[model samples]
Target chain A: MANTFLDRTALNDLLNGACFLGGGGGGPMSGARPLIDLIVKEYDGVTLVPYDSLDPELPCAVVAGIGAPDAATHGPSFSSAPKDAFLKLQAVSGTTLGAVLPGETGAMNSIIAALVAAQLGLPLVDVDSSGRALPTLSLAAYNLATEPTVLTLANQPVTDEQQATAVIETRTAPQADSVVRALLTTQAFEQEGAFSTWLMTAGQLPGASVDGTVTRAIAVGAALREARAAGDDPVEAVNAVLDGQLVRLSCGTLTAFSSHEGGGFDGYTIVLTDDDGHVVTVSAVNENLLAWRSDSDAPLAAAPDTLAWLAEDGTPLSNTDLRGLTAGTRLHLLGIPAAPILRTPLLAARFAKELAGIGFFGQAPRLD
Target chain B: MANTFLDRTALNDLLNGACFLGGGGGGPMSGARPLIDLIVKEYDGVTLVPYDSLDPELPCAVVAGIGAPDAATHGPSFSSAPKDAFLKLQAVSGTTLGAVLPGETGAMNSIIAALVAAQLGLPLVDVDSSGRALPTLSLAAYNLATEPTVLTLANQPVTDEQQATAVIETRTAPQADSVVRALLTTQAFEQEGAFSTWLMTAGQLPGASVDGTVTRAIAVGAALREARAAGDDPVEAVNAVLDGQLVRLSCGTLTAFSSHEGGGFDGYTIVLTDDDGHVVTVSAVNENLLAWRSDSDAPLAAAPDTLAWLAEDGTPLSNTDLRGLTAGTRLHLLGIPAAPILRTPLLAARFAKELAGIGFFGQAPRLD
Candidate 1:
């Protein structure tokens, strides 16, 4: 496949699809939009190349923003943090990364990866570490490797004068996740930072990464725009693009929303009530982790399955976006089956731990 | 000044003096004792060299333990953490450290520096970053340099199998302190870790550090030992060695103690009552930061100056050591004037912040 150059329209579609795929935790699209526009204006556009087209031995780095998405919206915009982390990682590790891989599929994270790629004159890999957004780096399939991983975290300037950055080399993904999360609490970071990790050669990508995720996101996003223009249901359009994996869980009024931020994550529970009096609750630590009807003992959907929301206009709503909606706002809840790779037993076990953190103990149910 | 070889006897004296110098915060002697014994056994003895004897361009690293001193007593003894941090910093920065500089004059911290020096077949510099144990690295005189400082923190195994380490480079000491403290909360660290920082050339030591600290500690320790053997007051012996810098603050019974642990530091307030009903309170966050008479608005002594406790048996009590004593235990509190270098205007400002953290907003009162 040829390399795809992203224009403004294509960038918008990609972000929309990534937001939907983020399952409600990829960071706010509002924060991502201006950044994406900046990237387009400054670098002209980002180049996304099929992973297979790269040399198998060419090294790549995964770039993403870490910490509570809502908190990120208020901080000194870490607009340069991803690039700083990327450059620092290269300098510290002495590894010349030839391409950039998105850490996960999220509006902000994916765009950050693209921005880094554009800034460095490198191509963005068509593959991602995780096909969907995850609350912790440990959940990314590519991060499960037993080999030592070297990660660099860079925060935006704490003041007009000082910047903080760290290089962590860990034996496991969980260790990296814990260290990075703890660092977000520092005065230098203030609950958000950008990180580059999981340096890998393309040869190591086949079994470790989700291929074609970038293309899939763009396709889904394009379908949403096309369906809306043609006056068809955009939700159905995205579902068709996802091979019928989307399931509408409810159409209701948001009745209550509560959230607490701690340990670098924004944990929240949203209660939705339909006109018929049926109620459903969605819980998330960063991304939506589990969702269940008020009367059901078992969860209606659990990660690695995706849970997301859409406004009446069919725009994908990130967790950051959802947090801004007041009670009585009409919304549509949807579940998208996780990519097949994410449903494998090993990945599923990891997802189960994330579910357990928010009080869900059962297995992840099928959403398709 | 000539090099002083630390035999078991000299090592013991150094630790004793360092403990008293640590005020109340340096790690417990119980923990430092074994590690000191191990170093003595393995390396025969550590070499303490006068700062003036080293080549002016010789690179050195400051070695110390970071986080709650008490928590360290229970974990897998970070017996190797200091050496690990030292070696990692050297390797990562490509600087062959010729000497180990003590981060502070404290029982455990000084010993750790000696241990690293011994393990690496390097010399232990007679100077220290801080003349007294401090609650934060920002208060260390050597750390006030405007140049970028690179620090490495290495944690003992989170389990029997995994170790975590991070390398942070920051433009200021406070930024490095904040980052390291934040990292201590990670699963890899669990509120305790060892660090090596303030890598510098021998030429940078003169104005930036407290000279003759190791010798001073040894002298103080030997005085205490000699006085005990001669049936004289050990407190008075230590005071004499300090050239009248030490003053008797109180001879009292422990009345109440309350402590809370957070942000990787153990903060506590201690109340003591004298025979005639005079009461004094000491406050510390990891180290004894301030002392005051209940009847007076002025502080008897504040950090930079030291507030140390001694058992009736003449043993210098670390904060960790003080915690185990029950109410009604007899203790002697002594105030020692800080090293002249530590009394500079810049360091005084730093100490003021530490004093303020414990609700003492006034200036760090002169102890002399």
Candidate 2:
């Protein structure tokens, strides 16, 4: 897919595709859609491509943005740094264009890429740093020995209107992460919690990393929208488009919720103890960081794959989205992680390092 | 003036010089002596020069090391992050050698300068970003007004060395405040925060922008050390070297203390109530962010020059010094800033606009 211009209709399928494709590590679907829509609306001429399809020689850049998913939903307006970060790359280096994607695939990763893509007039690639969603910055395939190569690293954040800041630097792939995560903390000020990076492949295929991802996302989105319109349940539409199964979900409210202040936005479980202790949990760190899988009350690993509370009609809802999620509120369970980030060391490293340092890592880390 | 090789003997004199030269906003002397000694002993090749004489062609850095005065004495360590921050910058940027200095001219500013300079094998630059000390990143001369210049700015912090999580990025000087502050918060969480930065000013007529600051810091330290050996009061020795005097000293114990979680250091205050039921309050964001001087049982206007606290024995102690300060331990106040940080717009701009957000202006902010 060269240029996938996703209209409003294709959002669902694209989200579903990105989710499972997130390989249990991409950002939640809810985060990427609204923000991406806002970006697309802000600039009507943007194009998104799957990471693998961008011309091997055409200039392209990897683009991704992250923030408190709550702020993203509420004050989603980004600080000017990332834009400055991107433009500075051009200022320092003469790279005209290249494929781009979030440094890793997480709940908010795609939208950040979409936002940058729409703004920079470059096609966003569908390939993700991780094959699926991840919890931390270092967990990208790009950073691993498999296909490690990063093209450009930049810092763009707008602390205030005229107080925008940016930096562009060249980096090695493994180190791309240190640059990305550091930039996130720097730009956000506690909010620097999110970061972005751009990369190009080395050797026989020399171009931006994650070449054809955007188009793939749109294709998935379009298929879901079509399925929904055809009267098929949105979950079915998602499964068919993504070759995934729409796990049955029971709607419920966040019996407990906390903003998990300091650094990221973290929330708690949806207990269906009403059904003789039928327990379910819904969690998030910025953009739905995780969800535990339950098989007859048995526990599964978290992060890479997630469960969500939504309207029976297939509308995803979170703590911020549904102020009062009642015990029996209609809910839907959707699993998405286009890139396999949960399986990477990135998640382990962040939880062990930062969150622990801040004393915010609440649960035991998963190593499955 | 040209170079100040602040060996152990020079600590007191430099502190007095910075305090006197600070005109009203320098820092305390308590922690400065030991910190200077700590740096000199550790590295043995430390030198401080005035900011004006630095050759533009020379590579240099600016760091905030040692314990932030208030933070050091508050049972936490600030030297960790500032010192660690710069090393990461060097690693990521692959730059070696240059100059280093206190980010400002407060208690830990110059002292940290020595600590980092010696530790990093760099000279301490006496020319601080601010002629005196100002509390915000914007207070430095190298700011937004000088964008697109070669003054590359980067920051790194370690919340958990285990995970080795930190943030690093280059940005306009304005946004650096937020970035660094966030890194500080991570430090606050970790209980020990210290960081350093090599404010790269290679392309901006580096000589014109920075003076021979490293030598000056060393000179100040040497003079004070000489005085101490001669049995002269460190304060008197410092004053004589810097051309200043000892004003009234307020006596009290810590009433409250909080970590300058923003990576500056942990902050605490000493409440000195004069005989007439009056309170002289001291507050610190990082290294005594501000001081409220007392006048005849009433707070004075911006009356105190730089506040330099000291042990009765004339020993210098900073928040990072970690000795002789407790919830009820006695303290001697060196009057400076004598006004709430919010009182002076000039000073407040550093904390408010640059560190916090600029949206706070327009309420007619002033020193109380």
Candidate 3:
């Protein structure tokens, strides 16, 4: 894929696509929207460069916010956390990062990387550690790497009294994930903070990340926008963009939903009823983990497979957006196959634990 | 005071004295006893040097364990945490510390500093950040310094699965204290870890620490031991060592005791009745905070004044040891004034918040 400039229209579409691909969690579009607007207004647009185009030895790090999406409203805004984390990582590691990579694919997480890259006058790599939003760092592709993961977290304190940052260096991804989650509960963070992780040279990116995710999100978003303008089925347009990989699992109503927020995640269970009276229950921890019909023991899809909800206007709704959804509201559930890199045994083992957490005990099945 | 080598007997005495001075918290004697024994057996013993004797510009730092004393029983042994924290601080700060200082005076906390100093072949400074064990870093004399406090925390994992370290740097003592406390709740720590903080040069130490605290503890311990061997009143011997500063407040029975542990602290309330039927109650969070007679409005003592309990044999009983006593067990309560350096306006402001936390809204009373 060629380099791209994220102008206003393109940035909006990318956010829409990334939110849908966020598979329910990612981050709130409301948070990403204003940040994107500010980025475009100030710097015109961020430059997105393909990962392979950069020098193989150029150091880079993944940047994203790590915490419960719902908790963001309660504390300091994350406007400065990403930049702060980025600089702190550089300071602690004694390496000058050449570019910024998205830690995961989410409206805010992805755009935040772009914002950091733009603000620092560095290129935003057209790739991400996870092709879709994941609840923990363990599920990201970079976790499969053999190198140590050094994570730096920064919280923008609401007042001058709170602690601003911490650096965690560990030999494994799971340990890093565990430590970061624990920090979110601290008085300084309060279940919300930004982080930079997976510091590595450009040569290591191809083996540890999903390439073209940024472009893919933009393409999917463009399709959604074009379909909405032409008054066509946006879901069908999105499926076409994925070469018919999107599985239309069910068209139903939001009959029931309950959410519990803690441990740096917004865990929820959603119950929906199809027009044919089939009931489906979905379980999630930040991102959608599993979906299954009540009448069948087999799951419709599990994590590592994109599980999404589309509104009547074909706009993607994140779990944050789904919270305000009322009973009987029309919603379409779609499942898109995860990036092939995410289906490997290494990544599968990580997702299995998360899926098992919500009652699904089997390996995540491929959607396409 | 002259520099002293910590022989086995001296080390034991130091532990006893530090535990007595720990007020109530400073870490449990049981934990410190074995470690001190091991240190003496392996390295012969630690070396203690007066703080001012070192080159005025030599870099140094304080090292100690930070967490609930009770929680230590459930997690990995902290035998290596102090050393780990010390090395990590040196690595992150890029400064070769010339000596080690005790973060606070406690049986385990004080001894751990000696352990780190011995292991690193560095001198253990006689001065301490707090003359007595304090519940939080905010109460330390070093908190009064204008320089930033860089704190490094390390947990020795039970298995190879946990993240072992974190570095926290902040402009104020409270923020550093808050961040470290938050990290204790993480899986990597679980309320027990070692930390090194207050990184500075020897020139900065005199203004930010209490001098001769180590020797003072040793003297107190020697008095207790000598009195016990002589079949004399150990409390009176201790008072004599302190130049009559120790006040015999009450001799009573442990009628009631309750403890609640969380947030890296073991909070408790104890009640006792003197021989004259006077009822006294003591409140503590790790270390004893306040003691008052139920019949009188004035507190017998409040931290940073030391409230201590002595057994029939004249041995100092830490709050951890007090937990095992049955109702009606005989005990003596003594009050010792805090070091003059701890009574400054700057340190008082920090202690006020902690005192207010347990329902004491007024200023900490001067025990003398």
Candidate 4:
């Protein structure tokens, strides 16, 4: 299990599964696919190693993109930029990194870790800080993970074209998260649409990373792809992959939608009305945070509990894609339990109030 | 002159003169004086050296406070914070700095250079990037300084309760300036107000720094103080120090005033109507940029020209203090020539259009 090598099928499945888990964030695969494809082709294959198998003293870096998910979908035409930030982290930390972990598991991030690992000739850990995509760095699973021996170094390079130029070194994950959040407001980064964030180490992976999430995402993708090919309902295939945890909430048409971009987030509220006159309102900053029934004040779903909305045909859409949704646009809503690590009382309290501030609230999914 | 030591009288004179030359910016001396007095009292004396007398290969830094000049006037008592940016510059540049130059001649910056020099055991160069104050880091003398065997290392320490947390290193001055400007927008700095900037070198001093400006500022201060003590008109005394170069422009009442703060700058436009019905409008973003005469498209004074507005009693006022001025408040305006280096066509063109965008335009004072 520690030496599993992902072939093309596993890679594609990982993308598909992570896209569904993105929950209207993690950016679109349109920008991520080509880069991952090139890496896989050039490198021949990528390694996925369990954190427990790695040397406990070896450091690991968390690799993920930062910014509004939609930025990549716009006209900028992103090429596979050099991994200067990755190399910078290595240089600044003065530590030789043995592996890289996904900062989160989502549309782009799940594969991004693999891509960086392939480029660096290192293994992609079978874990991530966020088992599912969530907005804001503070929500990173590594931030919530009990403190370990590893330190997080956040590096942003001053490339010729981009204006983001910052490097923060800190022992505390909260301080690292806070400083990078502040950097997001700079004139350059505020407009960056998508930037990169690299954090954590292999030693912290056992405690900080959501275990086996990479493999789980790939499994979800494989199930859906296989079911669709077999002439079975792909939506049902996704539900089966989650062990009946994917709860079908509603099927309706979007009646209203509005969003504003600020503080490095695209905040939006979506209203949907079913044919039977039932209404559902979903609020989100990047990922969908909460879903509420028309007559009930309580949340039907909340973060770190995830509410994923998709076309009935099972096309996963990011927040940017949601912008195109109009009145009478049909969609299906489903809820899934968040990663077990995020459900603990201590971790839940960390972002619960912030989640409520954006009109999202409810208990996170607890461990069985 | 290269080894001249600044005594109490010279230090006081520097403040007095810099206030007059600030062009209604550079912050007030209220906050700076105490810091300088403490350093001077503790150290006994601070060294002042002329740039031409120094070794050509040695590097120097331009040190000055950053942010809206008015911020220090508000709360958050500042003690001698560590010169991490200074130490960082030395560290990043990998050079032993020979001296430090004041970024500009201003209320606070005049003394700040000396204070840092005393703390670091370095001499204060008798030169500055700006002969007088202008807004924005790009306008700093070293930023405009043509060339010298020097590299700039801009450091900003994220301090809380006056303790610095981190330092960002870069070779480019604008990038350093940009990063620091962004830092100013952060919560701690936005309220902390006066941050510090150290850039340039002693070698760049000949081309970039205004030579003899330190002595000149002191002379101006001494003349004003002497006249006030002698019961002579202090305003007239200031004119005599400039050898009649200070042209009395108008004696008027403020008829209208408006300002906005953005990018850590207080941008304002002031309208003054003279007793004889002559009207003048002045525009500034931190430092006065232009003075427009009644019905004239041309400017009476422009950057890098100096326009000083003072109370009838000859007290110089920064833009922050002018915020308290009422529609019928009487004041006097005078225009002085800018430094010779700033008058160069190359340097003047750099910011001329930006100055014009803010409604400031005119030819700088030419050397006779």
Candidate 5:
């Protein structure tokens, strides 16, 4: 109640948190600002009920539009093709949402939740199915709990609709992944693919899937703000709160960072040598696949472990925006575990496979 | 009738044409093939109907799935998403589909049209809104007639009968685009960030909008096939067919090109010195966004003008593959006027102004 009614500040905090949990994706102040501003202007800070306290019986819908970031960024006029799918699922399952559900914990997902909730007049739930980034719907931890395939997908501005054929529905999760991959292949060819990347899974939609990840993100963001205001290293504060460490490493400028290169990012790698006769390396192609420490014998972080790389030298490196990485450029390598993402369909073994050509000094670590 | 009476080999040619028409963004041939194959398998190539021969009074629906390509590309399972939206739209408009309509020229779009036509017992139209490739439905030429804002987006799976709000009726294309963009932001932050790039648009769906880009592409492709069978260079043959010429450019190897390093992407410039000592320098960060004769001040193929880059030497580039480019390479640049993409409420001068930085070169080209 306080977060929504007591203060309007929560929206900003939530959006920032959403961005972090976005795992290099999702919207934040940039995307959420417009919607939030509109809400404040029109409704004067509509009190959003927290997911924990919201009534489950209320007939609300989890509204989400899934597609490519380029489509959303370059072509914002096309209504995402997935919202219609959500509605159909609601109708078919006889489940009516009293509130809109956040698809993930990222800033974009959280703010979208806020926007959808505000638009539909449903209280927003801070809960998201995947606490971290994933590749498809089957990766939803709640997949054991919900339908593997979404009910419907539609684009309002585009005026198009699709119904998955018999081939897509009956397939297994990985098989489904291939189907989605095929669809993406077309988009990839055109460099304009867009569709629902995250899925509701087979289980998880109703109960177990709903976690207040957004709330957690907001709180962390608020604390970071306070820490920054206090002249404290915001990174350190974030590290402490997230139960991680704050380390500074300059591993040359990023030579190449890819978002559209592979499935679920498949993780990325940064090549650099550290001081003190150490050749340190970090890879976060998809969800921080792994990290190699100074000594080749030891693994810093591995698949199933979550790792985030920030510019320890104070240069921000969100989602591998490494366009002009050069030799001798200072960069920080934040090694976090990959467990957060390992929860999805992508396994540590797969991560190992993706980085095979790159050849690591040590054996790839297994998942928890 | 001859074209419709396609054998396996002929169908492959058609698919190739469709792929070219798809403008590098289309789904796997497997999904599309089976649908046509199923028709052929069951009916032994029942009288194939061309778009011109379709019954004018017959109701039709342009269809394609709007979700992560990987997920939708699954083996084959019908879900509720697109079908729900399709049925809902059919009911809302009080118009039933007389035939299957393809929204764009992409290979998948054509296949989707064929699949729906085969399954629904409708004829597949040969016309498309765009004669070339575009990212959104708003770019379709159909919107040139009336900028319809209210769009009914839906998703229907093969088996589901339940349909309701799965169809979204929006009053404005931008509004729908906004909602869909937000939804995609959620999905990208969650998983399918890379794949969720392609989408539909108002201009794409409604009017003469690349209504049958696929069919036309197939036609062009057929010409190329003829040229190839006759041992002519595919490039020269295609150039002649499109009323265009193939300048040298390679996507696989970016060449000695560095145009700009802002936003993202390895921005670079391709320098081509014509035999006349006339130099044309093309710059691009991703796809060829701008092309101009560098020696002179005149603009080359601008924004609305679509350009396809070739790989090293003369390898034809598939728009879907990103690996088409490598380091330190020679290339060719082919300039083609953007197929007619009808202007929509969301994509008029105002929107074009916003996108001016990309240098969309062509004026809103009109078709005969």
Candidate 6:
């Protein structure tokens, strides 16, 4: 696989196309777009390396924002926070950083890693910790094992210009999730935060990450654009580009949508009525965790499968983007099977309780 | 000026005596006493080094509990959290820790340094970051400069029994304060947390810490005990032991006392009516920040100064201890001028805003 140089033009394509690939999480593109544009315009181009080319021992930092996607709309928008987190780890560990990987596959987080790679002059690894956006840190591939996932929060209060960073080192993924959640609820953090996690090496990338996610996201995004230009449904176009199945779950007019911010995340419950007069309820704690008929024991889809939403024109909608949407807005729902690494019994057992805690009562949807 | 070995007896005296010196903060004695006793008994007596006898270049870590003193009543009662924090600093910095200093002077924090020292077989430096307990991290003498303060929170959850450690490294005191406050508000940390902070060297102690606080606490506590035994006034004995003048602010029955937990500290307001119908109000965010008499524009005492309360029998009272007291209970109030270092404009200015934010409407008291 040849490395692609993402200049301003390719950067624009990735930014616009990645939103649909975000799987209804990854925050809204509006918050991160301008900064991404500015950085890409200034730098010659960002190098997007394929997974096979990375040296196993080369250290890489996974960067992403961890807060309500809406919160990123205010400030620190796609700035040096990710790069600073990477440098802080390097400075603390006395090790040099060699690459950058997005913490998750999302329109915003995915490209932010590219920006970091450009700023640092490092290769953007074609892999990510999560193949799609995940609400909690525990739901990721790198943390499924016993290795300590180090999380760094770079929160700069608007009132106090002093940027504060918190590094949480924990034994388990759940513990890291709890610590990150705690940081979000604290008075000092302004109710939201951004973070970089799973600092590891290229050698560990194969085992620690969902391989070749960047290329897939870019390809799907480009396909979506081409299909839309040719008067074809982008859903079908994305399906052709992605390896996993992207199933159209339902088409409906949203009858109701409501959400509240708590425990460092926005928990939302939405009701969409299909043309057949069937109502489907979706419950999400940050990401869309589960969806089921208004009257059913089994869920149509449950985490760690990817759940996504789109507008009539096939534009991807993040939860933050959905906030502006009204009860009568027309939408399309899609569900994609999770990556093979996320389907393991070990990871499923860990996520079962948290999913159920947030009103996900059904068993995890597995595609063996 | 020689270093004293704190045997079982001195450790007991220090533990009991330090509670009163805590100035209504530093957590409660109940959570720390047994742990203190166990460590001193097991070790060949902890070494307590006076500032004058120590080499200034020997690295020291200031240790204390960072959460609500009352919350320590639950599980994780003096686990290996403190020692773990010390060891983490050693591991990260690759510097051998030679001494320990209390982050603040209080019932629990005052003695936690001794416990850490005993556990590590290091000397306990007879100095503290603050001469007495102050609520916010920014109020300490050591943090007045732009030096980095490395803070670690070792919280062992009651449910999981897994210890979660958060390490925050920042350039300024306020940044460290914000980071620590965020950690407390996070779900990973319990409602209250204990931490070790400001890892520095023995040589930096002269410039960084309020000098001889451990010795001062010991002497004041010993004086109180002696006064009670000799039927003399314990308050007067404590006054003579401290260098600054101790003023008897009021003698009154507590009319009303109420507080609520917010932003990781207890914000409290109490009113006391003297026999002559004079009402005095004290405001505290963890530690008493200001006290004012009714109809007086000037406060009786303010932050940086030591404002303390005791029972008529001279038992030192923590805010947690005060919570259990009923209305109309008789208590004695004393105001001790702050240590000279904390009274400096540089440190006082840093604490002014936080004190005011917690309803304390007075200047930081100065001792010229």
Candidate 2: fnat, from 0 to 1? 0.00
Which lDDT tens digits does candidate 5 get at residues B210-317?
Answer: 544544565566776787677766667667766664443322234233333222122345555544545555544333444544233234444445565433333333
TM for candidate 5 is 0.41
**Tens digit per residue, CA lDDT, model 1, A1-368:** 99999878878988998998888888888878878888889988899999899999998888899998888778765578999999988998898999998988888887889889888999999998777899988788785443327899999885667788999988888788899999998888888899988888888888888999888888888987888788888788887898877898878998877777778999887778865677777888889887767444346777888888876667788877886776667888898887777866777777866754543333456776
Docking class of 2: incorrect
- TM-score of each candidate structure, all chains considered together: 0.51, 0.41, 0.51, 0.47, 0.41, 0.50
Residue A241 miss distance in model 6 (angstroms): 80
Model 6 iRMS (Å) reads 27.2
- Candidate 6 stretches with Cα past 4 Å from truth are A1-368, B144-146, B157-161, B326-328, B359-368
Report iRMS (Å) of candidate 4.
28.3
User: What are the candidates' individual DockQ scores?
Assistant: 0.01, 0.01, 0.01, 0.01, 0.01, 0.01
lDDT by residue for model 3 over B235-277, one digit each (tens)?
Answer: 8898888889988878989888878888878887777888988
Encode model 6's per-residue lDDT on B173-241: one tens digit a residue: 778878777787777775666676676767677777877778777787778777878888877788788
TM-score of chain B of 1: 0.96
Model 4 lDDT per residue over B125-229, tens place: 888776788676656556555321223223232444544433545555555556666666666566233333454545656666678888888888898778777
The CA lDDT at B149 in model 1 is 76
* Model 3 spans > 4 angstroms off: A1-368, B146-148
DockQ of model 5 vs. true complex: 0.01
Clashing pairs counted in every model: 0, 163, 1, 6, 161, 9
Whole-model lDDT for model 4 versus the true structure? Answer: 0.68
Could you tell me the TM-score of candidate 1? 0.51
What is the per-residue lDDT of model 2 for residues B1-368, given as tens digits with 9 covering 90 to 100? 55656555565556654543343233345545566656666766466555456676665655653223343344333344456666666665577747775666555565666677777667666555544454545555444224212222222233354333354454554465555555544534343334445345544423223243334434445655666678776566555544453444565554544344335444444345544544555554433433443332112312213455554444445443423465455555654322232234544445433311211111221222
What DockQ does predicted model 1 obtain? 0.01
- In candidate 5, what are the lDDT values of residues A279-331, reduced to their tens digit? 44455433344455434333455443444444434333335344334545665
Q: Global lDDT of each model?
A: 0.82, 0.46, 0.82, 0.68, 0.46, 0.73
